[model samples]
Target chain A: MTNVLVLFGAVIFPFVVGYILISRVPQLLHTPLMSGANAISGITIIGAMLIAGREGGNFGYLLGMIAVVFATINVVGGFLVTDRMLQMFKKKGNKNPQE
Target chain B: MEISLSAIGFAHLLAAGLFVLGLRFLSSPTTARRGNMLAAIAMLIAIVATFLDRQIVDFTSILLAIAIGTIIGAFSARLVKMTSMPQMVAIFNGFGGGASALVALAEFQRLSVQAQLPLPVTVTTLLSVLIGAVTFSGSMVAFGKLQGLMHGAPITSRLQKWLNIFLLLVVLVLMFLIIGSAPSHALFVILTVVALIFGVALVIPVGGADMPVVISLLNSFSGLAACATGFVVGNNILMFAGALVGAAGLILTQIMCKAMNRSLARIFIPRQAIQAEKALHDASGGVSESSAAKSDNKPQIDPLAAAVQTLSAAKSVIFVPGYGMALAQAQFKVVELANLLEKKGATVNFAVHPIAGRMPGHMHVLLAEAEVDYDKLREMDSINPEFKNTDAVIVVGACDVINPSATEVENTPISGMPILAARDAKSIIVCNYDDKPGYSGVENPIYQDAKTICLWGDAKDTISQLITSFSG
Candidate 1:
């Protein structure tokens, strides 16, 4: 159907663009880039939120709650860890700490 | 007030655009933090939009779960040591994968109550369950290997290949049965169980050294699982972001495979099988001559004293750090030594190999944490050509990256893997734990070379000694 075709197009578009952009990330930032990408994959939290907040049985809501918790941890932990790493990279300066 | 589906769709489209820009900003370190912030903001937008969906009737439980997750996630991120970063990433990946699986299961439960499930929804639900379960369990195995909770060596069995194949066949058959008839809870549960086992089987035979490739592959699997869930839930943003991450993980896996000079399949197929064939070849060849030479070449000079003399007289030096350096916790001492050498009128640079630490860019982060100037950290290709012109090369707890046998030997696990040109340096000082084969288990011939000085011991003690001797 047209709906399937449109969804496929959406998926392909982001994937191609992401591949082109991510391939250029230098070796120096590979770890941060990976952690950052992992965080982005936590977009599953959106699906979790819908399931959790839906008008469903107690068990369904509980399942959704657990999913939300897990996805949020991945999203939050991944980004913050990546930031902590990015903060460490400093260019050479005259006031060399080691010197 | 009810929100329109088109309004939510518009918000998702905007978030997707921001996600692309966020990744684009990661091309350089200067813009990377802003990129991360951008992506974080995108996530916020998506979450807020989801909360406004008309189907969402309850708010208290979801908000409470977010708070719990936030506290735990923030504390772990803020408290984890940089050295344990690979494990941290692996565990977080597991959480993401598990969430996707849970979402699919919840949706299945909600849909199963209906009279009939659409074929497309049923298919997507099955795919999500399979991929998500595998990602979750595979990542846990990776985390355990990296964190030393389990043996870091490849755990293989004679029947592993057969078992994995059988499991795949069973899963396929189950899919057919479920699609052929009305889906049942038991069939889905069985499929999830099989997929989880398959994940463990897929990663267990991989050695710790191959964890970077495995972790990246699992990241890709987690993304694909999310994409499948998106199809099940009919969510556009989930599909878009998931595909983006999936592509990113695959690209990283490809890069790692190239850097390590390994075929994609080699990471999973146990190296023991390859080594067995190599052993047969070596037994019939002139292998004993090399062993004899190695034994006769054992330490002839006081390498530590020689190392100190070379440090004092050298005008140019290159420092190579490997996983061993990280293991020895010698980054700070290494910086101290580099400073001493510099003060003594010697130029110093740190050569980082692409596969240097447990994961990609691991060594760079550790060196940066030790306050080493980013400019001084040269990547393998960029620094390799300079090794020959350098006067002294100080290898701190590194072995495989600079091993000559990788290029010199044939039919070995690391044969043809590009190595640092440390052998080309005029004088080499190695402060390592031992002259044993590294993670690849291939004997390094460079240690026995006449121009190389091996100061074998704990890297921290050895480096501290160098600092003291050079400063004095």
Candidate 2:
């Protein structure tokens, strides 16, 4: 139980601190912040695979399976999304059209 | 009991730490890539640690599930195009929300089958399940709209608002039924379906411009539902991370909403449903037809030599970027030009508008990706005072947001819209394609200003040229 508490510590501490810092900054950086944070969500899939495999109750395994699937799609598709979004500019050769 | 649950917990801790570093890096577009890579490494290590755990006796299902998902994930990543990225994000996010909802629902079923459910546990689980399902479905609908599988800005009338209000009322009723009496299987499914429909109803009427905020808000709801589920399951780490995501996502959503000068409640109001009614009463007026047509002409520039002379003599330079920069993908070249100018020790700070790009803080991320120093980026209010102090202001790929005329033009569609006043700067250089209208389709009178020089071209090409001219 204490170990669980400590495990809780790792996840909770950073989130709290991060939430505070980001909240204080100007709101304008939110999109970039979100895009950057999305990469970590991809990492979450990797985490899901390990925990789900180890905690193999039939129920846990199934739930884990779904989590792994969704998180993976999030990660890979997310990166692709970010990359594609960046490509919109290179697709067109212009300085700043429409002043 | 769970194979040194403490040690593995530490590993998760380390992974979460990596997530923090990654998130921190994400805060600035400049360090976003490094942040992403670091988080990926952390995630890989987390997988290895989890794999090493002795909790699971059988690995067969694990291997199969991973293999299938990996293949599917990899293929989708390869196939999704840049234009479709927003829709992909919406779809993937919906899945994340849906998975959490499913987990909660399954847990409830298991408890129900045993005929042994704790009172508090059942309530939280039901709450999570319904919210999660709704978020997932709603996100999918949003994706459809953004992808143009549905129309971009399908403005209906006041019925949209009434429906949204009615849905909220229904959600409250469902909550009461779930909490007061243990819901039967049919009721549970109905509750889930209604919530999902409510999610769709919530997003259906919003204009295309509001997608960024809508996406962020749905992300928050998904996180909140996950946190609620974590609580029901007695998983502390899951609860913590879920809460973190929920809170941060909500805050981000609020900021995004504010950037658009909108309130979260207003997003629910569905004014578009009343569009026809308002049109009949108000004679169907908003955008001026004449001004929209005025933006089509090719922009003319002042002499290059004279413009260069003006900039060379200026003491301070603040470059204001809008969606145009993102559309142009000119952050790298913009940074290069800034660096070139900074070599001469001209104080160059990026004046970022709150709603400058397609999303909130869009330009910051783009600039950060180019490795611009963090200190150089200033928000609208921060840079506003300095615009008076600055010698030259460069308006890049910006639209009416920079137009000085909008501040006073009450009759104009964008009248009273706050913008960076390049017209206010001593010598202003407007670097955009031409007089072509922006996304909102309005003309900028700032272009016709005596001091404003319009540098007409695509931003990337033009900035590169500007850099070359400087380098030579």
Candidate 3:
């Protein structure tokens, strides 16, 4: 019963909240926003970590290792790319002194 | 190394809160970077907590994988140009989905081999594999279309719709077989392969012009896949984060579709139906106004000389760029031109259409990379009224957005779509490679307006030539 309740909460609650939040975003920032959201979707990194950390033998280790690599790429690549894109939106007059 | 389950759960709850806060920050440009960082940090916490689990048996392989993934991710993120950002996002989305599918498969194999698979785990595992396979393959197709590795036109046949439905049903049946009785690994493998094929089929019919919507939709699919994987693994934080991404992506997809005055269903309509619809609309005189205007003889000006003369005399000018500017790799030159025009005493501004380039905000990012001031970039609503009083409008390689048919014609594909009011300017100068119609396949009557001067050549070359003439 708890699992079912969590499942419903996870699916429905976030969707409503996320829709309201995302609707407020300006069209100008849509691409960066999508990329940012993509970065967070790399939440699968948690599952991959579990698989890799589990004592389920060699095949599990192989699959877990591959999953970790791919999820890490999604996490690192998605966030960094979004940051790079957002940096371009800085006003021309106010140059950031720090790289 | 043995952390209490409640402690891990508490950490996950904290991480989920951070994810929500990150998404909230992403709603605005000023706070977007920090939002991304917050999410990244949350992911780091989740991964670290997972690593500390007592079940971990090996460290070397895990470290090796992390190293390889970081190097590849960081390098690609650093090196990929802003113009190819969409394709890179597609690739990353594909990787996420593929990872989820692999994780699910590994868990299923482990459970089934030990004959300890629970019903909920089996159902979620099958779902994870199905959605993951589709997202992985569908994103690859989207990436291919965006990168020119595959044709951008819709590939379709009369049987395409039925075939996709049939394929989906077959995969479902195979999934049921795997879950119903003594779980057959062979049935699961075949289902995964079939689901992958169905994914490819699903994306192939979507035309190139609709790729932004497809990319957004695929991003949502990847999130859903992750959510299913979370269920299989019983990870609440993963489930929550996946739900967040799924919802956010779907909302973005809807926004993109709305911007284009299209629906998700319309995008899936077979290519033949779309072509026929266009033909039917055209035959009913929906395009007659533009076609009639096209028959008029508008003078073809030497764009370089005309641009030089008009720009020199203009008090205010609006430069509207489209996908053509991106394709020409001429954003830097465009910025340079805007600067020169400013130097010549013209008040120069850029009119950005919401859906001007291949993706939302595509043009803004391109211009921003060229160091164009954010304040100078005007959205469609803000700039439309300025066109009438503007001295000149310089359209560099943009077509459909500036096409008067969008407003003047009826029953056409882009009839009711909002466009830049470049036609209201005193003089309009267009620099395009040719007189080719834009993505909508509608003849742009804006080219034939008496006040308009069409310059046929490469946008970069023409713009450069104009710069030289102006300077000389």
Candidate 4:
């Protein structure tokens, strides 16, 4: 049953990712599109998550921990980076005082 | 250790849902920010789940690593300027490629050392290595050029095209034999390096004029590589996502090519006589445009007087802005002007061309930032009809895109490209700092039109004066 669950995860995860990439990505950007995508791809922590939860060797668990930290950095780091870039545009947006 | 696919699957699904919605929202400048936010949210969810799921042996090291990366990423992002966003994007893209490449190469080393890799594994592994290496190097060259660390002109010389063909042959031969039977890892490494150089050569020669399109095309290549990597790893999510990106990027590349009136092959053509011929034509025609300015006879109207007339003269006005508009930081004032015009019972519309400004829908984003109504912003196809009904088309700080040269000039970079035909309007008033032609160095004859008028100055100041001229 757990194997079935794992298989289901593998099948469904791709569909979800596909939905995001196909129907959603093309709407607003192209130039800076890859940066956002790259930032998102740092989600390898999920792989680490599986490795971590599994009853693995001590070294395997250590490897999983390292991977999770890297993944977390990517996520939080990506958002902060994006916000910072957005700020520069905001500052230069327009000359209107009301705005 | 046993991996539970079900829990991870549900998490991936939710994350992917967010990713899709984020992408959809990004399509319109109106929703671009929201889309970015949604995507960010999805990333957050993905990261958090992955983090929590990991087995915690010693939490201190994990927390420290997270802390260090967060500080660095946040700091770097904050420090980067909007003007340099393109370069930053390239760098980030290179990182993804490099990471994937390193992963594939390391895995190959791991498997090779074990002295036995199945046929399927070997093939998938090599494909991943090849794609990743190419993407990594190509993206770095792109970043270097965009960052001004390298030249923007196409770096071409005689027989460079033939050289590329030879390189491709070597790369293919190397790929075929190595995958069939494992070779010395050192030889394979060298082969990968050579292919990486070829990737750099392929992109470095492309001119800055075609940058937006090149960026899209290279992006598609990267996505395709990612898909191959996913196959190697048996990661369905990576494959699906990569396919989506590849398809979208390819479509964008096509649209960009069409917009420039250039073929895909033209982008890769090296040291060809066709380009030389085009340059010759441009230089010959340029001499006449500078000399043709009608001297001293025509009456130049003051902006205030023009504004008063503009307010009273027409029922409908279409404002067409370009890269100049963005540079001027005048969108807010333009918004104000639009509002005033609307209040005075004049219908106002924004005409946006597909390839206008520096990127696709460039002016649209600037205007949306000014809080302009989304409905009022119209694409080229939709607004052409409105131009017929329009009494005035006030073109602001724009060039190239609106230049009649596209329709009239032959062999020019933008020849045969569609434009707004703003010159056809009953009254066309262009507010710009320069009477010169745009990007391709070709001259625009629109300034010579009988009804055409040029109000020259810095765009923001001129538009600000127009706002004052209108309010008073």
TM-score, chain B, each candidate: 0.94, 0.75, 0.91, 0.82
The candidates score, on chain A by TM-score, as follows 0.85, 0.54, 0.84, 0.55
Better structure of 1 and 2 per lDDT: 1
Worst 10 residues of 1 chain B by lDDT: B283-292
Query: Distance from true position, residue B183, model 2, in Å?
Result: 5.0
Model 4 residue B294 CA deviation (Å) reads 3.6
Report backbone clashes per prediction.
0, 25, 1, 9
lDDT for position B432 in model 1: 86
Model 3 / residue A91 / CA error / Å:
1.5
TM-score of each: 0.95, 0.74, 0.92, 0.77
Residue B455 error for model 1, in Å?
1.4
Compute DockQ for each candidate against the true complex.
Answer: 0.81, 0.25, 0.69, 0.21
lDDT of 3 by residue, B306-419 (tens): 667888889999999988888898888888888888887889999988777776678888998988877888988889999999999989888878877777767556667788
Q: Give the TM-score of candidate 4.
A: 0.77
Per-residue accuracy of model 2 over B79-127 as CA lDDT, tens digit each: 8643344566667677667766766765665556644456777777887
Q: Global lDDT for candidate 1?
A: 0.87
Question: What ranking of all candidate models by TM-score puts the best one first?
Answer: 1, 3, 4, 2
lDDT of 3: 0.82
Q: Where does model 1 exceed 4 Å of error?
A: A1-5, A94-98, B1-4, B273-300
Per-prediction interface RMSD in Å: 1.0, 5.1, 1.4, 5.7
- Model 3 off-target regions past 4 Å? A95-99, B1-3, B114-117, B175-179, B273-296
TM-score, model 2 to reference: 0.74
State iRMS for model 2.
5.1
Off by over 4 Å in 2: A1-18, A25-29, A39-64, A75-99, B6-58, B71-91, B144-150, B268-318, B328-349, B367-377, B389-394, B403-418, B427-472
